[model samples]
Target: MKKIALAFLCFLATDSMAQVSQDSTISAKEEIEIIEKDTLFIDMAKYKLTIPNNWKIKAGCTEEQCTANSPQDTLGGFDTYIESINITVNKLSSSSYTAEKYANFSIGYLPKVVKGFKVLEKKRLNSYSYRVTYTGSKNNIEQTWRQYYHVRSSKVYIITFSAQARKYDHYQPIMEPYLASFKFK
Candidate 1:
Protein backbone atom coordinates (compact mmCIF):
# COMPACT_ATOMS: atom_id res chain seq x y z
CA MET A 1 0.00 0.00 0.00
CA LYS A 2 2.84 2.38 0.95
CA LYS A 3 4.65 1.70 -2.36
CA ILE A 4 1.46 2.34 -4.40
CA ALA A 5 0.72 5.60 -2.56
CA LEU A 6 4.27 6.86 -3.13
CA ALA A 7 4.11 6.01 -6.86
CA PHE A 8 0.80 7.78 -7.24
CA LEU A 9 2.15 10.95 -5.59
CA CYS A 10 5.18 10.95 -7.96
CA PHE A 11 2.91 10.59 -10.99
CA LEU A 12 0.80 13.57 -9.95
CA ALA A 13 3.87 15.77 -9.49
CA THR A 14 5.25 14.82 -12.90
CA ASP A 15 1.90 15.49 -14.62
CA SER A 16 1.63 18.93 -13.05
CA MET A 17 5.13 19.81 -14.19
CA ALA A 18 4.35 18.73 -17.73
CA GLN A 19 1.17 20.80 -17.75
CA VAL A 20 3.08 23.91 -16.67
CA SER A 21 5.65 23.44 -19.39
CA GLN A 22 2.98 23.09 -22.04
CA ASP A 23 1.22 26.17 -20.78
CA SER A 24 4.45 28.18 -21.08
CA THR A 25 4.96 27.10 -24.67
CA ILE A 26 1.40 28.01 -25.56
CA SER A 27 1.81 31.42 -23.93
CA ALA A 28 4.96 32.13 -25.92
CA LYS A 29 3.33 31.19 -29.19
CA GLU A 30 0.35 33.39 -28.39
CA GLU A 31 2.65 36.30 -27.63
CA ILE A 32 4.26 35.98 -31.04
CA GLU A 33 0.85 35.95 -32.73
CA ILE A 34 -0.15 39.13 -30.91
CA ILE A 35 2.99 40.89 -32.08
CA GLU A 36 2.31 39.82 -35.62
CA LYS A 37 -1.20 41.24 -35.40
CA ASP A 38 0.23 44.65 -34.42
CA THR A 39 1.90 45.00 -37.82
CA LEU A 40 0.84 47.92 -40.04
CA PHE A 41 -0.88 47.12 -43.31
CA ILE A 42 -0.79 49.37 -46.33
CA ASP A 43 -3.72 49.27 -48.78
CA MET A 44 -1.82 49.80 -52.03
CA ALA A 45 -4.55 48.22 -54.16
CA LYS A 46 -4.94 51.45 -56.17
CA TYR A 47 -1.30 51.91 -57.35
CA LYS A 48 0.77 53.17 -54.41
CA LEU A 49 2.22 51.39 -51.37
CA THR A 50 0.02 52.01 -48.35
CA ILE A 51 1.53 53.98 -45.51
CA PRO A 52 1.97 52.17 -42.16
CA ASN A 53 1.54 53.26 -38.55
CA ASN A 54 3.73 55.71 -36.55
CA TRP A 55 4.13 57.60 -39.81
CA LYS A 56 2.59 61.02 -40.33
CA ILE A 57 1.27 61.50 -43.88
CA LYS A 58 1.55 64.74 -45.82
CA ALA A 59 1.79 66.08 -49.32
CA GLY A 60 5.24 65.73 -50.87
CA CYS A 61 6.82 68.98 -51.98
CA THR A 62 9.86 71.17 -51.58
CA GLU A 63 10.16 72.99 -48.26
CA GLU A 64 9.69 76.20 -50.18
CA GLN A 65 6.45 74.84 -51.62
CA CYS A 66 5.05 74.08 -48.16
CA THR A 67 3.38 77.03 -46.40
CA ALA A 68 3.90 75.81 -42.82
CA ASN A 69 7.60 75.13 -42.33
CA SER A 70 7.46 74.94 -38.56
CA PRO A 71 6.34 71.95 -36.52
CA GLN A 72 2.76 72.10 -35.27
CA ASP A 73 1.66 71.53 -31.67
CA THR A 74 -0.33 68.37 -30.95
CA LEU A 75 -2.06 66.87 -27.95
CA GLY A 76 0.87 64.49 -27.47
CA GLY A 77 3.04 67.57 -26.84
CA PHE A 78 5.50 66.44 -29.51
CA ASP A 79 5.01 68.89 -32.34
CA THR A 80 4.50 67.34 -35.76
CA TYR A 81 6.88 68.55 -38.42
CA ILE A 82 5.79 69.82 -41.80
CA GLU A 83 7.01 67.26 -44.28
CA SER A 84 5.57 64.92 -46.89
CA ILE A 85 5.56 61.22 -47.84
CA ASN A 86 6.10 62.47 -51.41
CA ILE A 87 4.86 59.61 -53.57
CA THR A 88 5.81 59.71 -57.28
CA VAL A 89 4.43 56.82 -59.30
CA ASN A 90 5.27 55.98 -62.93
CA LYS A 91 8.02 58.61 -62.81
CA LEU A 92 10.82 56.07 -63.00
CA SER A 93 10.81 53.05 -65.28
CA SER A 94 11.52 50.56 -62.46
CA SER A 95 13.64 50.61 -59.30
CA SER A 96 16.45 48.31 -60.40
CA TYR A 97 18.66 50.12 -57.93
CA THR A 98 20.60 48.07 -55.39
CA ALA A 99 20.39 48.73 -51.64
CA GLU A 100 23.56 50.80 -51.87
CA LYS A 101 22.09 52.76 -54.75
CA TYR A 102 19.02 53.57 -52.70
CA ALA A 103 21.15 54.62 -49.73
CA ASN A 104 23.21 56.89 -51.97
CA PHE A 105 20.06 58.33 -53.42
CA SER A 106 18.82 59.14 -49.92
CA ILE A 107 22.06 60.88 -48.89
CA GLY A 108 22.03 62.82 -52.13
CA TYR A 109 18.52 64.23 -51.62
CA LEU A 110 18.46 64.68 -47.85
CA PRO A 111 19.94 67.58 -45.87
CA LYS A 112 23.70 67.72 -45.23
CA VAL A 113 23.20 66.75 -41.60
CA VAL A 114 22.62 63.24 -42.88
CA LYS A 115 26.37 62.59 -43.06
CA GLY A 116 25.89 59.08 -44.42
CA PHE A 117 24.16 55.95 -43.15
CA LYS A 118 24.68 52.19 -43.37
CA VAL A 119 22.06 49.75 -44.61
CA LEU A 120 20.94 47.52 -41.76
CA GLU A 121 18.32 45.46 -43.57
CA LYS A 122 16.95 45.27 -47.09
CA LYS A 123 13.99 43.22 -48.34
CA ARG A 124 13.42 42.93 -52.06
CA LEU A 125 9.68 43.10 -52.64
CA ASN A 126 9.91 42.49 -56.38
CA SER A 127 12.28 42.59 -59.29
CA TYR A 128 12.06 46.34 -59.62
CA SER A 129 12.06 47.68 -56.05
CA TYR A 130 13.40 46.97 -52.54
CA ARG A 131 12.80 48.11 -48.95
CA VAL A 132 15.81 49.33 -46.91
CA THR A 133 16.70 50.55 -43.43
CA TYR A 134 19.78 52.61 -42.53
CA THR A 135 21.20 54.71 -39.69
CA GLY A 136 21.89 58.28 -40.72
CA SER A 137 22.56 61.48 -38.86
CA LYS A 138 20.58 64.69 -38.53
CA ASN A 139 23.88 66.63 -38.43
CA ASN A 140 25.75 64.66 -35.81
CA ILE A 141 25.71 68.29 -34.56
CA GLU A 142 24.39 69.29 -31.15
CA GLN A 143 22.63 65.91 -31.04
CA THR A 144 23.02 63.19 -33.65
CA TRP A 145 19.44 62.22 -34.34
CA ARG A 146 18.83 58.76 -35.83
CA GLN A 147 16.91 58.31 -39.08
CA TYR A 148 15.54 55.32 -40.98
CA TYR A 149 14.11 54.90 -44.46
CA HIS A 150 11.79 52.32 -46.01
CA VAL A 151 11.59 52.42 -49.83
CA ARG A 152 8.94 50.43 -51.64
CA SER A 153 7.13 50.52 -54.98
CA SER A 154 8.71 53.82 -56.04
CA LYS A 155 7.81 55.37 -52.70
CA VAL A 156 10.28 56.13 -49.88
CA TYR A 157 9.38 56.28 -46.21
CA ILE A 158 11.72 58.25 -43.91
CA ILE A 159 11.58 58.28 -40.14
CA THR A 160 13.58 60.37 -37.66
CA PHE A 161 13.01 58.51 -34.39
CA SER A 162 15.54 59.46 -31.72
CA ALA A 163 19.00 60.90 -31.10
CA GLN A 164 20.51 57.74 -29.67
CA ALA A 165 23.79 56.79 -31.33
CA ARG A 166 22.87 53.14 -30.84
CA LYS A 167 20.32 53.63 -33.58
CA TYR A 168 20.27 50.01 -34.67
CA ASP A 169 19.44 48.71 -31.23
CA HIS A 170 16.54 51.12 -30.97
CA TYR A 171 15.06 50.87 -34.48
CA GLN A 172 15.84 47.35 -35.72
CA PRO A 173 12.99 45.53 -33.95
CA ILE A 174 10.41 48.12 -34.92
CA MET A 175 11.74 48.81 -38.41
CA GLU A 176 12.12 45.19 -39.56
CA PRO A 177 8.43 44.27 -39.18
CA TYR A 178 7.34 47.68 -40.37
CA LEU A 179 9.24 47.14 -43.58
CA ALA A 180 8.07 43.55 -43.83
CA SER A 181 4.47 44.59 -43.28
CA PHE A 182 4.48 46.31 -46.67
CA LYS A 183 2.55 44.41 -49.35
CA PHE A 184 1.81 45.30 -52.96
CA LYS A 185 -1.95 45.52 -52.86
Candidate 2:
Protein backbone atom coordinates (compact mmCIF):
# COMPACT_ATOMS: atom_id res chain seq x y z
CA MET A 1 0.00 0.00 0.00
CA LYS A 2 2.84 2.39 0.86
CA LYS A 3 4.58 1.62 -2.45
CA ILE A 4 1.34 2.28 -4.29
CA ALA A 5 1.00 5.69 -2.53
CA LEU A 6 4.61 6.58 -3.33
CA ALA A 7 4.16 5.60 -6.96
CA PHE A 8 1.03 7.74 -7.19
CA LEU A 9 2.84 10.76 -5.69
CA CYS A 10 5.75 10.34 -8.12
CA PHE A 11 3.33 10.22 -11.04
CA LEU A 12 1.63 13.40 -9.90
CA ALA A 13 4.94 15.20 -9.52
CA THR A 14 6.11 14.12 -12.97
CA ASP A 15 2.84 15.27 -14.50
CA SER A 16 3.11 18.64 -12.79
CA MET A 17 6.67 19.08 -14.01
CA ALA A 18 5.62 18.24 -17.55
CA GLN A 19 2.89 20.89 -17.40
CA VAL A 20 5.38 23.45 -16.17
CA SER A 21 7.79 22.58 -18.93
CA GLN A 22 5.08 22.89 -21.59
CA ASP A 23 3.76 26.15 -20.17
CA SER A 24 7.20 27.73 -20.21
CA THR A 25 7.19 27.60 -24.02
CA ILE A 26 4.14 29.92 -24.17
CA SER A 27 5.12 32.11 -21.21
CA ALA A 28 6.01 34.98 -23.56
CA LYS A 29 2.36 35.82 -24.16
CA GLU A 30 1.66 35.74 -20.44
CA GLU A 31 4.77 37.84 -19.85
CA ILE A 32 3.59 40.33 -22.47
CA GLU A 33 0.20 40.56 -20.84
CA ILE A 34 1.87 41.35 -17.54
CA ILE A 35 4.30 43.83 -19.09
CA GLU A 36 1.28 45.54 -20.61
CA LYS A 37 -0.17 46.35 -17.20
CA ASP A 38 -0.16 50.10 -16.52
CA THR A 39 -0.90 52.42 -13.63
CA LEU A 40 -1.01 56.11 -14.57
CA PHE A 41 -3.92 57.81 -12.80
CA ILE A 42 -2.50 59.17 -9.56
CA ASP A 43 -5.04 61.75 -8.47
CA MET A 44 -7.92 60.36 -6.41
CA ALA A 45 -9.04 63.92 -5.52
CA LYS A 46 -8.19 64.03 -1.79
CA TYR A 47 -5.03 61.97 -2.26
CA LYS A 48 -2.93 60.71 -5.14
CA LEU A 49 -1.78 57.12 -5.76
CA THR A 50 -0.17 55.20 -8.60
CA ILE A 51 -1.59 51.73 -8.84
CA PRO A 52 -2.43 49.52 -11.84
CA ASN A 53 -4.64 50.64 -14.71
CA ASN A 54 -6.99 48.64 -12.65
CA TRP A 55 -6.51 52.06 -11.12
CA LYS A 56 -9.16 52.92 -13.67
CA ILE A 57 -11.11 50.84 -11.23
CA LYS A 58 -14.45 49.14 -11.74
CA ALA A 59 -16.13 49.10 -8.32
CA GLY A 60 -19.09 50.53 -6.45
CA CYS A 61 -17.17 53.37 -4.84
CA THR A 62 -18.22 56.54 -3.08
CA GLU A 63 -16.15 59.66 -2.39
CA GLU A 64 -15.04 58.68 1.13
CA GLN A 65 -14.32 54.93 0.90
CA CYS A 66 -12.98 52.80 -1.92
CA THR A 67 -11.89 49.25 -2.61
CA ALA A 68 -9.19 48.53 -5.17
CA ASN A 69 -8.24 45.08 -6.32
CA SER A 70 -6.31 43.06 -8.87
CA PRO A 71 -8.07 41.36 -11.80
CA GLN A 72 -8.23 38.13 -9.80
CA ASP A 73 -10.54 39.74 -7.28
CA THR A 74 -14.31 39.46 -7.55
CA LEU A 75 -16.40 42.59 -7.98
CA GLY A 76 -19.49 43.84 -6.03
CA GLY A 77 -17.31 43.11 -2.97
CA PHE A 78 -13.83 41.79 -2.18
CA ASP A 79 -14.75 38.51 -0.55
CA THR A 80 -12.14 36.99 -2.86
CA TYR A 81 -8.93 38.55 -4.20
CA ILE A 82 -5.30 37.81 -4.79
CA GLU A 83 -4.52 41.44 -3.94
CA SER A 84 -6.60 44.36 -2.64
CA ILE A 85 -6.33 47.71 -0.98
CA ASN A 86 -8.95 49.57 1.03
CA ILE A 87 -8.74 53.30 1.72
CA THR A 88 -10.80 55.01 4.39
CA VAL A 89 -10.76 58.61 5.54
CA ASN A 90 -12.37 59.87 8.72
CA LYS A 91 -12.62 63.10 10.67
CA LEU A 92 -12.05 63.07 14.37
CA SER A 93 -13.88 65.34 16.77
CA SER A 94 -10.79 66.21 18.77
CA SER A 95 -7.88 67.83 17.01
CA SER A 96 -5.37 66.35 19.45
CA TYR A 97 -5.88 62.72 18.50
CA THR A 98 -2.87 60.68 17.37
CA ALA A 99 -2.62 57.70 15.03
CA GLU A 100 -1.85 55.30 17.84
CA LYS A 101 -4.94 56.35 19.75
CA TYR A 102 -7.10 56.26 16.67
CA ALA A 103 -6.01 52.72 15.78
CA ASN A 104 -6.60 51.51 19.31
CA PHE A 105 -10.10 52.94 19.30
CA SER A 106 -11.30 51.79 15.90
CA ILE A 107 -9.41 48.54 15.36
CA GLY A 108 -10.85 46.88 18.41
CA TYR A 109 -13.70 45.68 16.24
CA LEU A 110 -11.38 43.89 13.83
CA PRO A 111 -11.43 40.59 15.66
CA LYS A 112 -15.20 40.61 15.58
CA VAL A 113 -15.19 41.25 11.84
CA VAL A 114 -12.33 38.82 11.14
CA LYS A 115 -12.61 35.22 12.25
CA GLY A 116 -9.11 34.70 13.64
CA PHE A 117 -7.23 37.94 14.06
CA LYS A 118 -3.53 37.92 14.90
CA VAL A 119 -1.41 41.03 14.83
CA LEU A 120 1.90 40.41 13.12
CA GLU A 121 3.45 43.78 13.77
CA LYS A 122 2.42 47.12 15.26
CA LYS A 123 4.71 50.09 15.34
CA ARG A 124 4.32 53.77 16.15
CA LEU A 125 6.80 55.59 13.94
CA ASN A 126 6.22 58.70 15.96
CA SER A 127 3.52 60.31 18.04
CA TYR A 128 1.29 60.87 15.03
CA SER A 129 2.33 58.01 12.73
CA TYR A 130 1.62 54.31 13.12
CA ARG A 131 1.41 51.09 11.15
CA VAL A 132 0.18 47.56 11.68
CA THR A 133 0.41 44.26 9.83
CA TYR A 134 -2.09 41.64 10.75
CA THR A 135 -3.58 38.43 9.40
CA GLY A 136 -6.83 36.55 9.85
CA SER A 137 -9.51 34.43 8.26
CA LYS A 138 -12.67 35.93 6.85
CA ASN A 139 -15.29 34.40 4.61
CA ASN A 140 -13.23 31.26 5.09
CA ILE A 141 -10.21 32.75 3.37
CA GLU A 142 -6.87 33.40 5.07
CA GLN A 143 -5.76 36.97 4.39
CA THR A 144 -2.90 39.21 5.40
CA TRP A 145 -3.44 42.92 5.99
CA ARG A 146 -0.93 45.75 6.21
CA GLN A 147 -2.33 49.07 7.40
CA TYR A 148 -0.80 52.51 7.66
CA TYR A 149 -2.32 55.04 10.02
CA HIS A 150 -1.57 58.60 9.01
CA VAL A 151 -2.70 61.43 11.21
CA ARG A 152 -3.04 64.94 9.83
CA SER A 153 -4.52 67.35 12.36
CA SER A 154 -7.99 66.02 13.22
CA LYS A 155 -8.21 63.68 10.23
CA VAL A 156 -6.83 60.17 10.05
CA TYR A 157 -6.25 58.43 6.74
CA ILE A 158 -6.11 54.67 6.82
CA ILE A 159 -4.48 52.93 3.86
CA THR A 160 -4.80 49.20 4.00
CA PHE A 161 -3.31 46.61 1.63
CA SER A 162 -4.64 43.11 1.89
CA ALA A 163 -3.95 39.92 -0.06
CA GLN A 164 -4.56 36.23 0.06
CA ALA A 165 -2.04 34.73 2.48
CA ARG A 166 -0.72 32.39 -0.18
CA LYS A 167 -0.22 35.23 -2.66
CA TYR A 168 0.88 37.99 -0.30
CA ASP A 169 4.61 37.63 -0.88
CA HIS A 170 4.26 37.69 -4.67
CA TYR A 171 1.99 40.75 -4.90
CA GLN A 172 3.13 42.80 -1.89
CA PRO A 173 6.35 43.89 -3.54
CA ILE A 174 4.51 44.98 -6.67
CA MET A 175 1.77 46.89 -4.85
CA GLU A 176 3.18 47.99 -1.50
CA PRO A 177 5.51 50.80 -2.63
CA TYR A 178 2.52 52.86 -3.79
CA LEU A 179 1.75 53.48 -0.18
CA ALA A 180 4.49 56.10 -0.20
CA SER A 181 3.01 57.74 -3.31
CA PHE A 182 -0.03 59.04 -1.50
CA LYS A 183 0.05 62.83 -1.72
CA PHE A 184 -2.82 64.76 -0.17
CA LYS A 185 -4.31 67.38 -2.41
Candidate 3:
Protein backbone atom coordinates (compact mmCIF):
# COMPACT_ATOMS: atom_id res chain seq x y z
CA MET A 1 0.00 0.00 0.00
CA LYS A 2 2.82 2.44 0.91
CA LYS A 3 4.63 1.80 -2.41
CA ILE A 4 1.42 2.35 -4.40
CA ALA A 5 0.66 5.62 -2.59
CA LEU A 6 4.21 6.91 -3.23
CA ALA A 7 3.94 6.11 -6.92
CA PHE A 8 0.57 7.86 -7.21
CA LEU A 9 1.93 11.04 -5.58
CA CYS A 10 4.95 11.04 -7.91
CA PHE A 11 2.66 10.63 -10.89
CA LEU A 12 0.53 13.60 -9.87
CA ALA A 13 3.59 15.79 -9.44
CA THR A 14 4.95 14.78 -12.82
CA ASP A 15 1.60 15.45 -14.47
CA SER A 16 1.35 18.87 -12.88
CA MET A 17 4.83 19.76 -14.03
CA ALA A 18 4.04 18.67 -17.53
CA GLN A 19 0.91 20.79 -17.56
CA VAL A 20 2.84 23.88 -16.48
CA SER A 21 5.46 23.25 -19.14
CA GLN A 22 2.83 22.90 -21.80
CA ASP A 23 1.16 26.09 -20.69
CA SER A 24 4.47 27.90 -20.90
CA THR A 25 5.07 26.59 -24.39
CA ILE A 26 1.61 27.70 -25.44
CA SER A 27 2.20 31.17 -24.04
CA ALA A 28 5.45 31.47 -25.96
CA LYS A 29 3.78 30.43 -29.17
CA GLU A 30 0.99 32.94 -28.64
CA GLU A 31 3.52 35.69 -28.12
CA ILE A 32 5.21 34.83 -31.38
CA GLU A 33 1.88 34.86 -33.16
CA ILE A 34 1.08 38.28 -31.77
CA ILE A 35 4.36 39.67 -33.03
CA GLU A 36 3.83 38.09 -36.42
CA LYS A 37 0.38 39.60 -36.64
CA ASP A 38 1.76 43.09 -36.23
CA THR A 39 4.21 42.79 -39.09
CA LEU A 40 3.48 44.04 -42.64
CA PHE A 41 5.68 43.52 -45.64
CA ILE A 42 6.29 46.58 -47.82
CA ASP A 43 7.99 46.26 -51.17
CA MET A 44 9.37 49.36 -52.85
CA ALA A 45 11.06 49.97 -56.17
CA LYS A 46 14.50 49.03 -54.90
CA TYR A 47 14.01 47.85 -51.31
CA LYS A 48 11.63 46.09 -48.97
CA LEU A 49 10.87 46.11 -45.26
CA THR A 50 8.57 44.53 -42.72
CA ILE A 51 6.93 47.31 -40.78
CA PRO A 52 4.30 47.20 -38.08
CA ASN A 53 0.76 46.92 -39.40
CA ASN A 54 -0.42 49.78 -37.21
CA TRP A 55 1.68 52.22 -39.21
CA LYS A 56 0.06 53.67 -42.30
CA ILE A 57 1.64 55.23 -45.30
CA LYS A 58 1.15 58.99 -45.20
CA ALA A 59 -1.39 60.50 -47.53
CA GLY A 60 -0.23 60.71 -51.16
CA CYS A 61 2.77 58.53 -50.43
CA THR A 62 2.83 55.16 -52.12
CA GLU A 63 4.53 52.03 -50.83
CA GLU A 64 7.29 52.74 -53.30
CA GLN A 65 7.77 56.11 -51.62
CA CYS A 66 8.68 54.39 -48.33
CA THR A 67 7.03 56.84 -45.94
CA ALA A 68 4.73 55.72 -43.14
CA ASN A 69 3.30 57.37 -40.07
CA SER A 70 2.09 55.84 -36.83
CA PRO A 71 -1.34 56.60 -35.47
CA GLN A 72 -1.60 60.08 -34.04
CA ASP A 73 -3.48 61.87 -31.30
CA THR A 74 -3.51 65.46 -30.21
CA LEU A 75 -0.69 65.94 -27.78
CA GLY A 76 0.78 69.13 -26.32
CA GLY A 77 -1.84 71.14 -28.14
CA PHE A 78 -0.48 70.12 -31.51
CA ASP A 79 -1.26 67.45 -34.08
CA THR A 80 1.65 65.07 -34.31
CA TYR A 81 2.44 61.47 -35.01
CA ILE A 82 3.46 59.04 -32.33
CA GLU A 83 6.10 57.80 -34.74
CA SER A 84 7.10 57.80 -38.38
CA ILE A 85 9.41 55.87 -40.66
CA ASN A 86 10.79 57.34 -43.85
CA ILE A 87 12.92 55.49 -46.34
CA THR A 88 14.62 57.58 -48.99
CA VAL A 89 16.79 56.55 -51.86
CA ASN A 90 19.61 58.85 -52.86
CA LYS A 91 21.82 58.51 -55.87
CA LEU A 92 25.40 58.22 -54.74
CA SER A 93 27.42 61.17 -55.98
CA SER A 94 30.28 58.85 -56.72
CA SER A 95 30.76 55.11 -57.06
CA SER A 96 33.36 55.17 -54.31
CA TYR A 97 30.86 56.49 -51.71
CA THR A 98 30.50 54.02 -48.82
CA ALA A 99 27.67 53.40 -46.37
CA GLU A 100 29.84 54.31 -43.43
CA LYS A 101 30.86 57.57 -45.03
CA TYR A 102 27.30 58.47 -45.87
CA ALA A 103 26.14 57.59 -42.37
CA ASN A 104 28.85 59.68 -40.77
CA PHE A 105 28.15 62.59 -43.07
CA SER A 106 24.42 62.40 -42.33
CA ILE A 107 24.91 62.30 -38.57
CA GLY A 108 27.48 65.08 -38.75
CA TYR A 109 24.97 67.26 -40.57
CA LEU A 110 22.08 66.70 -38.15
CA PRO A 111 23.39 69.03 -35.47
CA LYS A 112 23.67 71.82 -37.98
CA VAL A 113 20.02 71.64 -38.98
CA VAL A 114 18.17 69.86 -36.18
CA LYS A 115 17.12 71.85 -33.17
CA GLY A 116 18.63 70.81 -29.83
CA PHE A 117 20.37 67.91 -31.48
CA LYS A 118 22.05 65.41 -29.18
CA VAL A 119 23.67 62.15 -30.17
CA LEU A 120 22.70 59.19 -28.00
CA GLU A 121 24.50 56.38 -29.77
CA LYS A 122 26.17 55.56 -33.07
CA LYS A 123 27.22 52.09 -34.07
CA ARG A 124 28.12 50.13 -37.15
CA LEU A 125 25.90 47.21 -38.05
CA ASN A 126 28.54 45.79 -40.39
CA SER A 127 31.28 47.01 -42.70
CA TYR A 128 28.75 48.56 -45.05
CA SER A 129 25.85 49.29 -42.69
CA TYR A 130 25.49 51.80 -39.89
CA ARG A 131 22.92 53.16 -37.45
CA VAL A 132 22.66 56.32 -35.40
CA THR A 133 20.35 57.48 -32.62
CA TYR A 134 19.80 61.06 -31.66
CA THR A 135 17.30 63.40 -30.01
CA GLY A 136 15.96 66.76 -31.08
CA SER A 137 12.99 69.02 -30.67
CA LYS A 138 10.34 69.75 -33.23
CA ASN A 139 7.50 72.19 -32.57
CA ASN A 140 8.67 72.41 -28.96
CA ILE A 141 8.25 68.67 -28.37
CA GLU A 142 11.29 66.50 -27.88
CA GLN A 143 11.69 63.58 -30.25
CA THR A 144 14.07 60.70 -30.59
CA TRP A 145 15.24 59.43 -33.94
CA ARG A 146 17.17 56.53 -35.34
CA GLN A 147 18.60 56.26 -38.84
CA TYR A 148 19.89 53.12 -40.50
CA TYR A 149 21.83 53.28 -43.74
CA HIS A 150 22.68 50.71 -46.36
CA VAL A 151 24.72 51.49 -49.47
CA ARG A 152 24.29 49.33 -52.53
CA SER A 153 25.14 49.77 -56.19
CA SER A 154 25.46 53.55 -56.39
CA LYS A 155 22.37 54.04 -54.27
CA VAL A 156 22.15 54.90 -50.60
CA TYR A 157 19.06 53.72 -48.74
CA ILE A 158 18.19 55.67 -45.62
CA ILE A 159 15.65 54.30 -43.14
CA THR A 160 14.70 56.80 -40.48
CA PHE A 161 12.55 55.89 -37.47
CA SER A 162 11.30 58.68 -35.24
CA ALA A 163 9.18 58.63 -32.09
CA GLN A 164 8.36 60.75 -29.12
CA ALA A 165 11.37 60.76 -26.83
CA ARG A 166 9.50 59.36 -23.88
CA LYS A 167 8.15 56.49 -25.97
CA TYR A 168 11.40 55.43 -27.56
CA ASP A 169 12.06 52.46 -25.26
CA HIS A 170 8.43 51.37 -25.42
CA TYR A 171 8.59 51.27 -29.20
CA GLN A 172 12.07 49.80 -29.59
CA PRO A 173 10.87 46.23 -30.03
CA ILE A 174 8.58 47.22 -32.90
CA MET A 175 11.14 49.47 -34.50
CA GLU A 176 14.12 47.13 -34.29
CA PRO A 177 12.47 44.35 -36.24
CA TYR A 178 11.18 46.79 -38.84
CA LEU A 179 14.68 48.12 -39.35
CA ALA A 180 16.15 44.63 -39.36
CA SER A 181 13.77 43.50 -42.08
CA PHE A 182 15.02 46.10 -44.52
CA LYS A 183 16.44 44.48 -47.65
CA PHE A 184 17.92 45.96 -50.79
CA LYS A 185 16.70 44.54 -54.05
State which candidate, 1 or 2, has the greater TM-score.
Answer: 2
| lDDT of every model, 2 decimals | 0.37, 0.64, 0.69
Task: Select the stronger candidate by TM-score from 2 and 3.
Answer: 3
Worst window of 10 by summed lDDT in candidate 1 = 62-71
TM-score of each: 0.39, 0.68, 0.74
Q: Write the per-residue lDDT of candidate 1 for residues 134-170, one digit (tens) a residue.
A: 4555534222222334445554444333323443353
Best by TM-score: 3
Task: Point out where model 3 deviates above 4 Å.
Answer: 1-32, 62-64, 73-80
Candidate that scores best on lDDT: 3
Any idea what lDDT model 2 has?
A: 0.64
Candidate 1: lDDT of 42? Answer: 25
Compared with the true structure, model 2 gives a TM-score of 0.68
Residue pairs in collision within model 1: none
Ranking by lDDT: 3, 2, 1
lDDT, candidate 1, equals: 0.37
lDDT by residue (tens digit), candidate 3, 1-185 = 53453344334333333221112123435545644764455565567776655555544444334576665534455655568889887889998898889987987888876799998988889966888899998778889999898888887888899888877776666467667778877
Deviation (Å) of 126 in candidate 2: 4.4
